[model samples]
Target: MANAASGMAVHDDCKLKFLELKAKRTYRFIVFKIEEKQKQVIVEKLGEPTKSYEDFTASLPADECRYAVYDFDFVTEENCQKSRIFSLPGLPTLQE
Candidate 1:
């Protein structure tokens, strides 16, 4: 599928990986990049289930923009097991 506003298409692999992450918990995180040459969004990296959040942060380029999805798992106050998928889009900047 293509984004009308950006005129960019999302690669099939990108969609497949996201589904796997959400449905199967196949990866801890998935990083996506916009390949200008291909005019499409592509999967750049897949973080293993054992990878930490710090590892995911380290995978991002300092100067470039990226799209990422992270599987965050936690125990609720009542001790219920829960998981949520987080979408991190665009450049993340540090405020002084």
Candidate 2:
């Protein structure tokens, strides 16, 4: 969403892909970046379902800011299936 304060809006595809990831588990993770020239937030990358967390981390740029979401799934000790969605904003980069 665009706002007077930020002057940046999220792209439509960003929301659609996020919904697909959240509701359909179509992606393992998604990386988002702000396009200063476009003044918009857009998807930079989409991880495959078989990609690992390390892969997701590696996709981040060393000197840039980014937002990301990871769909983490695991089995509980009680043998219950569970899933958690992790949102990472302005993640600390290697430059930091």
Candidate 3:
């Protein structure tokens, strides 16, 4: 799902050009950026990327994307990487 027009946060690394992650917590993300130096990850709601600080926090609204689909593309540079996209359990209604 290479959404060229999506508001999805992208990484800076030329190698790993996207913020690919495993939705272990069943989190739906609108924003996800990377800090290669600090190894810090910034997750924010769907919006313009302005402040990508270490303390920045973004959470999805309960009303927004209560049910959504996630698609991921795998990428790697020096590390073998795997990407995933999943929905929260308990609400099978939200199957993408």
Taking the tens digit of each residue's C-alpha lDDT, what string does model 1 give over 1-96? 545355887877887888899889999999999899989888999999999999999999999999899999999999999999888864221100
> Residue-wise lDDT of candidate 3 within 44-93, one digit each (tens)?
33322333322123343444433222334357795766555543322131
Task: Output the TM-score of candidate 2.
Answer: 0.86
Alpha-carbon runs more than 4 Å astray in model 2: 1-5, 90-96
* Model 1 bad stretches (over 4 Å): 1-4, 90-96
Candidate 1: C-alpha lDDT:
0.83
How many steric clashes does model 2 contain? 0
Better of 2 and 3 by lDDT: 2
Best by TM-score: 1
What TM-score does each of the candidates earn? 0.88, 0.86, 0.22
Order of the predicted models by lDDT, top scorer first: 1, 2, 3
Candidate 3 RMSD to the correct structure: 14.5
Residue pairs clashing in model 2 are: none
Task: Write the residue-wise lDDT of candidate 2 on 1-92 in tens digits.
Answer: 53334567777777788888888999999999988998988899999989999999999999998999898989999999998878886432
How well does candidate 1 score on lDDT at residue 91? 20
Best by lDDT: 1
Model 2 lDDT on a 0 to 1 scale: 0.82
